[model samples]
Target: MRISTRTSISIRSCHVRRNGPHRSSQNAWKWVASRSSVELAGTGGWLLRNGKGLAYPTPAKSNKSMRSGTLIVLFQPNEERLLSAKAMIDDGLFQKITLPSVCLAQHCVPTKGGTIAVKPGRVLGYLDSLKFRLSEGARRHSCGTFHTGTDASIIPDYADFQLDVRTFSENTQKLAKAAVERIIRKECEVAGFPTTPRMVTVVSSPAIYNDAVATSQFTRVFEWYYGRRASEVVQEMPPDIVADDLVLLALPPGGMPIPYVYWNIGVTDPETWERVSREGELRDLPPTHSAIYAPAIEPTLRIVIEALALAALTFLQLL
Candidate 1:
């Protein structure tokens, strides 16, 4: 290292060049003299220019990268509610929710940006939430007061969203239809599906979603496969229909009990339905409670006794 007469300086030192901060050329020779040992490892403390500290290397697999995605669907009024329900079932979302999948009506909210899917067990909740966004498609579905100023506004455009709920309801209904049929047929143990056909009819075509589509679909599916024909109820079809969930058999004319199906696949034949209602003081019992219980022991015992008595009477008459 040397200094020019004009006072500029030059130094030959890659260490200083690589490490920087040689002060001035005046100490260049001094450093070279002491340069006996100065080795650097790839430590970030290279020149130590940054005393503020540095960041450690982070792993590539962050939580943001691994988090599950959320899904939401938008609805236009004309489309049936079941379309989304079916989409979820086909994709297995209800399994994710772990609830009895039903044809529940949904309301959409076009919020800050995304639309939220609001599913209330009862149709009223969905309707109330839908008002959050005034949809161009929401027509005929009036929300207002009725005569006497009674708030009859809750009754929705039954048709408007009836189909929407089919996705949830009919899926359950389809199950209900099969279970009721089986209970009637005496194929399955009564403990699982002890409801009468009368009660079963009421729940499947529940007054709420009981439009022509829901009613006829549920009734047709159940009756065709396992119910007794006319000589009993209205027009009847042959009993070749496919029955699932449980298999039912044809009842004697006016002999079949109505069936009631709950979302949980809990079922009730009519006699059991009445017994449970009269048995329990609580109206708040879940839809599945009666369906889960054994047909009362008393009733079964009575039937057995009656059958024995009839047999003895028949024997005596024959003699």
Candidate 2:
């Protein structure tokens, strides 16, 4: 019996490994392709690397055996601006890859380290950019040139600028946009402009509402992995930064609404987090768009990788 036992044991081992408690072949997974218009801030590239499994694996090919689901990384051009995700879709992203059972993404925040933030409902608000163009006479005679202290003599014609509006609810967004347009038209009428100040929406981003059930389950798994360090907070996003990718994943044609979780990892160091906590404000922290807004790299990268990995593993669990 010993002569033939080794072959039988090897076969059993392979079968058990493939259908192991940790392995999953039931559902496919997708990671958003990472491309950026601007140079990334501290440790921002970590998301692209870690999400693609480049950081943890020794050799890239080693991931093939363990990988059960399709991992999609969306591609974007360097010159592409807003609506990057939409560009990917229009380019046939869905047609090229297997639709995912779930989508996951993470972002860096200036909050304290070792903490996670999850808002179950309406994590992000709808965003719209309105640009108003004033005619030359409207600018000089009616609106007047914007006074710059250093350059007061500079007079401009055909003034154009963009305004952003964010709304928490979908209906509110529509109402607000319409109301804004009406108010602007009325203002132009009062100002006696030759033509109604032309209003154009340059960018529109839909609101992101996380699935309540899925978010709760994922949060539980996060806490189980990271313990008390993991907790939720309400984080305000900069008006210009919209999670459009998440929006794309949630909507139809691409696929049905899949469970997705977009979480944040704190970039500030322990020392800075403590100081800011004592001060009771984020004033000391650099604003996200500032040139000096560099996050603590090492700890931030570690936490981000851990958070993303935990979510993926939990979703792929066999039992």
Candidate 3:
């Protein structure tokens, strides 16, 4: 086999519908060819490396020469809880597999059908789940009585449960954490508690900053291909919704500093999208994470496949 330089690509998805055809994988394999392969047992992931000895013909190719690159696709499970990604890293995912030069991921949103939305700079923010515990006396005395009149009694020891904080910047994340801790401590002091309230972090995920140059280049390409179907959204994202995969890729072990792109594609049908568009709000739309929230599958799959294939080909040309 001929030895050639390899460019690694990584694909990750939070959720994959069961019992449906593997449209993305099939389209990807058909679009790109490779000589060597490695599969992750039970995860349904693949690592494909293309060398000079093997040729994968594409529309861009003039001759029969093969392109040099590697593509690693990772399908993450347990998307609802967002825990499987962290588990994979702890198990040494990047250490065992080839590291990608750049990482790419996309989400299905409730926007108008065929629309692609993206933004520069910080595409997502940091997410942290904090828990606060307070004794019965602290709660009753500081906040309020459990009941009124004769029925009034001290509240049982309780915790604030899960308080989620999303910060757009690292500095903001630090300030938010500190402010939360300070507020809890002050409440305990005011309640005359013998000890300070306990604070715990249930989960923490960092923010993602897209590379400016790379983002601009891709935005033009998307607009050129999709025209009116592509857009750049200026609205802020909800803080509690953490993008764990991109955050994990930005950190150690993975340590990929190259440009990373995170974009959104609409999953709603044309009729529903038109209705929501006419209404001028998403209140009528089924929001993500809701039991009723379901995306139109066929169109979604086709759009996603096309976007991924185009992105891979564009990046390969640069290589």
Preferred candidate (lDDT higher): 2 or 3: 3
Q: TM-score-based ranking, best first?
A: 2, 3, 1
lDDT of 1 by residue, 1-319 (tens): 1000000011122232322233232343233223312222222211111110111001111222532321111111112121322333346443443221112111111111111111112221111001011112223534443222245644332211111112134456566555545544463234232322222121111222212333243334334433454123222221211111110111112344222111111122335455666877335433211222222222222222222222122222211
Q: In candidate 1, what residue range of length 10 has the lowest lDDT sum? A: 1-10
Cα deviation at 177, candidate 1, in Å, is 36
Q: Evaluate model 2: give its lDDT.
A: 0.53
Q: For model 3, where is the 10-residue window of minimal lDDT?
A: 45-54
Q: What lDDT does candidate 3 reach at residue 109?
A: 71
Best model number under TM-score: 2
* Distance from true location, Cα of 118 in model 1, Å: 23
Q: What is the C-alpha lDDT of each candidate?
A: 0.24, 0.53, 0.54
Candidate 3, TM-score vs. the true structure?
0.68
Instruction: In candidate 3, list every pair of residues with a backbone clash.
Output: 7-69
